[model samples]
Target: MLYFDESGYTGPDLINSKQPYFSLASIRMTDEEIAQIKEEVGYCEWGRELHFKSMYKSYHGQKILDKIFNHPLMDNYHVLPSFAHKRYCIYANIVNILVETMYHFNGINLYEGAKNLILANGLHCFAILHSNKDLVAEFENNFVGMVRKPSIESVANFYRTTDKLRYDVDTREGFFDMLSEIPPTIQYIKEALTHKKFYIDLTIPLFSVSIQEWYNKTKVKENVLFDSSEPFFANIEFMESLRDMEVPETVVGYGKGKHVYPLPVGNMEIAKSHEEFGIQLADVFASALCFALTPRNDKFVKYQDKIKSLPIFQNIKLNIAPSTNDFIEARMKETAEIDPLDFLCEHSDRININKKSNI
Candidate 1:
């Protein structure tokens, strides 16, 4: 069985400046193995419970983390960590749900390869370059509103927000072209969702990604458990679908870029960390990693390199800013090869957006 936990999650409101990064840590360990971690890490006895916050505040607890991380138990693939930049995640979600819808309308292959990721990163990088913090915030806020409660007004607000963008990226030409194809009705967009087959909350992708990482390493479809209190607790069904996705024998991409499917992972239940030692450990791993990446302030910043460079950290996967530039450069096309990006640029027609149907 595998245990899961999360830290630094600000729920669906990713625009929160409080914590820009969110981490989900996973560990596969038997009761005996868990006991070994406790023994090696000098597990605390005085605290009401063993978790990251209390453990990290004291010297003894910090020392315990070191022991736990370096213990032979973690030497293999037993412990896996993954995180996402909250700010970029919102933009990527916009691309995934909104912009991807736009691409679908223009007859583009939205999920043919790594295009979804590349497109998401495309928006991520463009937002950074646009240099309009207020605008970005407004857009994020609207997206959050839409995801929480989808409606015509929310959809209209989101679409109107995109209309506010005044410029475009030359390298990722037509990246913003989704604006042109954005459906006026929320139903249309929902019906035409690009990856809704297994789509969960924007926050859950890292969770799903972590499962794939474990599956790739162990080739096992195992039962998983999560701290019920986590933000993505509501997406249990979606998690199951990811595990049951109909992936073909053909694999795609290479190395970390590689894509494996049907995830070889399924079944989920929620439990309080107090009842599960592995989840408690996951808490420490997630909290420690998140604090290092985004410390509360200068007062908490120490041993960042040691914390970030732990032997296990080397194998940890990250979901941060986009690798979009390389994708666009590799295309080597004089014109935008993907539709929607090149939609209005070269294939523009005077068709009215509101009149479009079939999502």
Candidate 2:
């Protein structure tokens, strides 16, 4: 099985200064294969669905996350003032729970030192990014007999490689559009994948949970560590715990857009459009997970919390569900309506009521 994923380090510039790396991680395994592996590890089925709607209900009751929103601590902080902030907070927390649950069930902590275990069991892990060479190489050196492949780019262009293959995969336009809005430092991620040598035999699906869903699942309290910030930092912490694991053939994929990459745990399909190009469900799941777990700094952690506390963040959610296309359309509309003559007016408000909305 192949695991791939992507991650995003999104927050105000202030927070990003501390922790700058954002990533995702995904893993792939067949039901039969995972069952055999789980049996060996003394694990069992905990749930059925991976979607937030199903997972939330299975883990906690509806509106269970209201507690987080109603917390007095939330009111003290101005960062997460609206329901949207509450929603984002909940989504991050739910992901943390799922990852932690998986770790405990597997009798392995990807963060605590799973790499050594993986290597002992014969697994290969490879990361594609020019920037992570030092970290990747460090792991390669520690885990003997483990193969590490290096690609000289931040992003891997699986689209170009799999263009010939046919599969029933979701469109990537939303993802790509999200990537375009990021700063130059992040923009290179897409450019890096344009080169072909980095291609791998995998596909990854990245999707974000809706704000309402995020809020519903996150409100519940669990006897788990809560980071009170972007969950990626915690995810990286978990991955770091497995730095010593040796596993055969590990692949990581990053989503270059707005989609919150999907998490895969149960039944899914793997198919090909043509023999030359096709993808398996496992490949996509792995990639998405890897990306989500990428790390950033303390600055990002603080900024994320602050963003979550802001009233504007909440209004943004109600005004328009947060999305790449919605943001772009809104910006384009504003740009088109700007008037030089009105710039000097003290209270000039421009409104284009007839523009097409494409969110």
Candidate 3:
């Protein structure tokens, strides 16, 4: 069976800087391994769930990381990691196309008074956009000709390999460039999340692509259990839909038998409580994975330094490349390139997230 959890998620607002990436991770383990992990990481007297974030600060937390990483049973667990770089994620592509498309339908009103116009124009009010009119007009006029809602088949084909941007480790210019890449339409919808379904729509494919590879390689029929939460993506219908999904054939990493395989998903549910040891273990693994990859400086360097000494430091199961100089380098080892537009535009065997019905 598989126990899954996520970290660094900030809903549909993929551009949120506080969360650099939306990541999902899973550990495949048997009942015996679960009991062993529980006994190793004992519960507190208050019966609080052993979360990695709060614990990583204390000695006990370091000990927990050590135990999980060094446990003799480590060889028995197979890890699945999937994530999206928030700075220029797949949603950035979709929002870019959507903004360009709005221009054809009189984008001035949509950009300036997007919320009101979206409501008045009889389009889906998925989210609201807030930008200065002059700036939006400049953006539209500059790129409208070069931009079109990419064909459903080739949406993931962006400037990944050749045309890439460079940035200093920590600089104001770098930060601003990342923000400028996001389309105004995405900003509006993310801020006014009146419809929670958009968040669900954006995240499922990230998980699906990763889980598909895990199944393809290991041939494990997964019976998934998610940590108990009321987030839009954790709903019963969404989890069930994961059972039948096919990554596009043209997708980057899903060449043949890679991420394009049968999902043979079994029973799936939100775990009633974190007392379930598998969920807690997954929580720890997910949090630790994020902490290791997150940028480090004055504020987070200490955590990064400490993480280097852990048994899981550079563990093959973690799947992050040592250096991510290019777009393909940034992706998880086994997952396909994240093309949110392609996922949204495919419109086959997926919950439709088209702007018309989405609003």
Candidate 4:
């Protein structure tokens, strides 16, 4: 069983400046294993539930965290986490909402041959390089508005900003075809706006990514627990549906990142963190990793020192926010490395995008 907990959850407001990243961590252990870990870290001495922030504050607390993060059981292969940069979540959403809608309208399989990843990363790298914050902010705000209420104004604004962005950069490398169909896609969004099923909160998609990661690692139905302290009220129903659902191979193929089981999931529940030692450790990992990724935080350095180099075999760290060009380049390179032939053949249209330019 794996106990899951998260840090930096601001509902669907992914662009909230106060918390730019969300981290979800899970540790797999049996009851006996949890007891062993608690004993190893002297968790019972606290006489209360182990909370990460309070424990991370004091010198003694830091020592305890050091012991917990470095415990023999929490080895490199055991640490599993899913980290999402909120802004990047929106970036990917912009592509998925607009471009994926376009593809669906045209009866094309965006997910086939991993084209979704290629286009999302391609659009993101190009937008950050060529588009200014105001332009991007307009696009992002319109997206949030459209999802929340689906206003005609929001769609119009989004369409205008998207239209400008598409032409701003040369489209030879990127999928301009997706952009060309924006009008029809906007019409689709307008019609579907009233359907609650169509407008998923930002948290749902990123949370889905994490759930898939968990199932991918375990590949079996297992008990997954979440810290009830942070209310992901939106996640509960979606999670329940995942366990009960199944799909045909044509709809979703089985593979490393794809769903192996029809609808990969097991039993998932919510529990108080204080009552669950495994959940508490997940809290530690989520908070520490979230803080460590934020450059301005002083604990960023100290926290990274304590948590770095841990064995993390299954993870999702979506750091697509604009930090450096190298960050974008490195991730794109990883996509290519995953399936060089598929990437080469499928992304032939994007060959020029692989090159760097002033635009």
Q: In model 2, what is the error at residue 227, expressed in angstroms?
A: 3.5
Q: Could you give candidate 3's per-residue lDDT for residues 55-119 as a string of tens digits?
A: 87777666666666677765433555555555333334334344434442443422222222222
Q: Which stretches of candidate 1 lie over 4 Å from their true place?
A: 44-48, 167-200, 241-262, 318-320, 324-359
Question: Local error of candidate 3 at 44, Å?
Answer: 7.1
Score each candidate by Cα lDDT: 0.65, 0.25, 0.49, 0.62
- For 1-359, candidate 1 gives per-residue lDDT tens digits of 89989888766667778787788888898889887777666664544456777777778777776777778888556888778788777767766666566666768756555566665665666667666677767777887777766677977888677667534333234545533434443445765443343332445677766777777777877788899775656777655554444434334433344445444676788888888888887887888778777754455565666687786666454455555465545533322223322332222122223225424
Q: lDDT for model 3, on a 0 to 1 scale?
A: 0.49
The root-mean-square deviation over C-alpha atoms between each candidate and the true structure, in angstroms, is 8.3, 25.2, 12.2, 10.0
Q: Ten residues in a row with the worst lDDT in model 3? A: 119-128
TM-score of each: 0.76, 0.19, 0.57, 0.76
Query: 2 or 3: which has the higher TM-score?
Result: 3
Judge candidate 2 against the unseen true structure and give its global Cα lDDT, from 0 to 1. Answer: 0.25
lDDT by residue (26-85, candidate 4, tens digit) is: 777878888888888888786677777787778888888888877888853455776777
Weakest ten-residue segment in model 1 by summed lDDT: 345-354
TM-score of 2: 0.19
Q: Please name the candidate that would achieve the greatest lDDT relative to the true structure.
A: 1
Ten residues in sequence with the least summed lDDT for candidate 4: 335-344
Off by over 4 Å in 2: 1-68, 71-162, 165-326, 329-359
Candidate order by lDDT, decreasing, is 1, 4, 3, 2
